[model samples]
Target: MATATYQNGSLSAASLQGFVLVGFGGGAQAQALLFAVFLAMYVVSVLGNLTMIVLITRDARLHSPMYFFLKNLSFVDLCYSSVIAPNALANFLSSSKVISFEACATQFFFFSLLGTTEGFLLAVMAYDRFMAICSPLRYPVTMCPMVCAQLALGTYCGGCLNSIVQTSLTFQLPFCSSNRIDHFYCDVLPLLRLACSDTTLNELVMFGICGLIIVSTTLVVLISYGYIIVTILRMRSRSGRHKLFSTCGSHMTAVSLFYGTVFVMYAQPGAVASMEQGKVVSVFYTLVIPMLNPLIYSLRNKDVKDALKRLGQRHSLVRDGSQ
Candidate 1:
């Protein structure tokens, strides 16, 4: 049992050492099955993102603002997937499922940092598309290399600031009751349910901050896409319109997969018992989205395919020379 104290006429855990993560419970067979499934996904996500990063860095053809932002996005997806997968995968096989306060906070921190940054990066990508399609003449000067670096930096900054607030606010609450987190990993909603005292401030902060980030970034995407659609329609060449549409379509698919779950997870009252349903939503964004992003972009994008082909040919030539 966790040690507790009564302060301000309420219960609080003065010496709450840690929490027990009550992961998705099941039989041995089920656990093994889940473990295999998640392990495969984690491997694919890591490999795919790493390949995208290497290809973008190695290929001169991908040295553009679009690919620059994409490289950063891949980096985020890679780390974001890392923050939770290994621990959860281990727990699936091990009997001990305990996590200390500090460890959980660290997990929450990086997850929040990278995930939030991705939203901003996606919005920036939408704006990049808008400028490239709508204002072809000044696209280069407007989205110069230095400018892309600054934008990427800004996304990280935004995510860091939000994460600071979220981590501090969520972890500050006193956990007086059971120290069980009913989720696969440390998450805001599940942890909030464990707070012993009134969590009015926590609720408001979570609601307000989540709303601000999601709404603002989503607005940028929507407005940028609005102009992109108009510009694409005005293009005379069917081939040109089709190419532009195809590229923009990939971004839209990723955005929908990401924001749809976030809106459902954080946009509502996290304290509600029903929010437990967000497990599926959380899995999609954290696991499935990262694994699918590289596929969506590489398969749908002609440039990425060409770069892969070129990279393969170079490898083959080196092998033949060695022989």
Candidate 2:
């Protein structure tokens, strides 16, 4: 841990060379339990996301705009989950939860990049759904392969830019002495609190940027769903409406779970108790959501379920032939 030189009286006491993450502390037994739980969740999340990606690639039935987005989403979840879960699990097992400045900064950067990218990707997925439902005839033309590729690329570019600004702005602040970060990961708000310098401008800028991303993407999702609803209502076939609702419902559930926890953790006003609450909520969005996404999509979607079944039967036949 290389310490920052403090010149003048400007540097506050909270500045430090490295940070100690005092994660959800319970007794040793409790930490052990948490480690087991998180380890299990991590394994499951990776496997689940990988399975979805493989299914999407191998199954011709899933080769559509919607699955394209889903494949990307699964990839994001896999990478995002990897960013935090392994380190967190290690901290739970190790006595010292210390992270050097460079490592922490790197973690923060990737976390923000992937998370912001996923947000934009979800909005794009909603638009894909809207076009599919609201304009079935024109959907093929409107959401061509080129268009889908462009949308996906745009989300990645946007997320990278957002993260660069945020990570640079955050690490530019001086930390005087306080090396303790209360949260599990190197999140923005908790890191901001440790800054020795005035963080009003930083906070405001971060809030503005995050707010813009969240609000704009959310509006796109809402508008897409709004149009989708009107179109569904006008349809004569009940079964067709049911199918549309089913697809949208899975996406809506995912969006709600993700945005709901994120908003609670970052956007809302906090009480002293809210910090504790934020940790729990962060676990859900950061760890649990990634695991749940594949399950939600697979269970709700007939196409995925069918693909899984075919995959299983094919494997069984291969095994029997070897016998």
Candidate 3:
């Protein structure tokens, strides 16, 4: 872990002892209440995402490109949420909310990588849906298993590159002003405020990279859906149109929930100014959204429901035979 060093009456990020995350400060009662709420949420997030992963991986019926993407999405949700929730939950009950310099950097690195990767994956999913709906015959060949794996790999690579740049720029500066992070977790925006030196470059690069990721992916989703909608409209069968819309509906909802919060949090220029709002927004994206995704995908989809039913039936059969 990089220790803080003092030089010339200033403390560089390396010289910093650590940071105090003043997470949702109200009082003992408020902290306790929030602790309970967030703990429940974290448990739900873990269980729901795990169930999705288990179901997707075990069930033969969910072997298509869409579920393949959905499985990865669940895994990302599982991972990225774990990166934040456990840390935040621990802080809620502790008297000291201090996190070491290296620890903070690690949190930001994984969070950025996983979160950004999900954005790219979601866009990839949109393309998958577009191909499935608009060019059904070509869909299998184009989105072959090899191609899908490559696309998933590509998302992680893009996210890693983005994380490297953001983490490098944000942490290399002097954190002499204060060792206090105003939000729940160690995000780039909050950390940027603590830098004593000029962060013009950091802000610019963050805006540029984050903007490119969000905007480009969002455009992919929108354009894909536009084509998907047209194709659905032209379908002569009512049931076919309904099924197509249903298939895309879950992805669209997930995209909307995930992307909207991200755009406001990262891409919006004024985001850093409001720490209180940032905390709420951060909580939503980090905790609430992950918990919601599995429910959104599963409740609205017939295949997952049937898979769950089948899995339950098989378990029951095994139990009865053993008895």
Candidate 4:
């Protein structure tokens, strides 16, 4: 809502109509190269997530609670990649690299929404694994269709609330100092750095909310896995142990990637780093992780691979028949 004002070659708060995203610094060729790289990543990530969603939905074999959550996670990754990747790619090729106030706010909202939703969804998936491994007899009753739907709905609602609070608080601050966002996107920390007013309260609230979400969800996952580990140790069958580990391994890999980058970004708020360093780390979570998720799941899980193979065969048969 900040309007741009210019006076005698000077930019003022009134003149702040939009923000300049200082994405990356390089010559024309370098930027073009970066553009190509990011575009390829974006394409791959979108296609991979979409494929996962379609496979999960179409395959009746994947109708369980685990795949139900996996499908939702893939959808979140699809949207999450979109919230930042396309804009960043365009900025890589654009001269001005300017984003309107509305666009910035919108991007921040959906980015936070999907990120928060994914966090909670991961924790829920962890619980699902724990139930299956530890309480296999009661798993069906515990994680019924209604329960799974409710859990998914809860994550979406939680994400919306978190996004509303964070986005509203962030944009409420008076950004009189400058409109240059050092990082690639309109993230909390980068935007906070641009505010002229005292941001101690904002910082505290942001930290508290983010900490609560991350710490609480992480604790749930850890506790779930702890019980799972115990159960695995007690199991008599070696094949059973291997199967459970394989199923859990993919989820653990995703959790590690997501939580590792998030903790680095938010845990040490006092640790100062270069904008370029922040950008690199952000790229890992925002872009790289999403793209890696489907690969991790499919390559590790035989069920998904089998599903893909079946789908491929069906498509080939249909094509041959049509010809």
Q: Provide the TM-score for each candidate, comma-separated.
A: 0.95, 0.95, 0.97, 0.95
Residue-level lDDT tens digits of model 1 in 231-271: 89988999999999999999999999998888888877743
Q: Which digits, one per residue and each the tens of the lDDT, describe model 4 over residues 29-107?
A: 9999989888888898999999999999999999999999999999999999999998998898888899988899999
The order of the candidates by lDDT, greatest first, is 3, 4, 1, 2
**What lDDT score goes with residue 223 in model 2?**
99
- Model 3: residues with Cα > 4 Å off, grouped in runs: 1-4
Per-candidate clash tally: 0, 8, 5, 5
- Worst 10-residue stretch by lDDT in candidate 1? 270-279
Output the TM-score of candidate 2. 0.95
Screening candidate 1 with a backbone cut-off below 3 angstroms (N, C-alpha, C), the clashing residue pairs are none
Give one digit per residue, the lDDT tens place, for model 3 in 5-86: 7776567876687898888978889989998999999899999999999998999999999999999998999998999988
Could you say which candidate leads in TM-score?
A: 3
lDDT score for candidate 4 against the true structure: 0.90
Pitting candidate 1 against candidate 3, the one with the higher TM-score is: 3
Lowest lDDT sum, 10 consecutive residues, model 2, at: 7-16
Over 49-139, each residue of candidate 2 has an lDDT whose tens digit, in order, gives 9999999999998999999999999999999999999999999988889997888989999999999999999999999999998888999
Which residues of candidate 2, in runs, are more than 4 Å off?
Answer: 1-4, 9-16, 269-273
lDDT of each prediction vs. the true structure? 0.89, 0.88, 0.90, 0.90
For model 3, how big is the CA root-mean-square deviation?
1.5
Each prediction's RMSD to truth: 1.9, 2.0, 1.5, 2.3
In terms of lDDT, the poorest run of 10 residues in model 4 is 6-15
Error of 3 at 70 (Å): 0.5
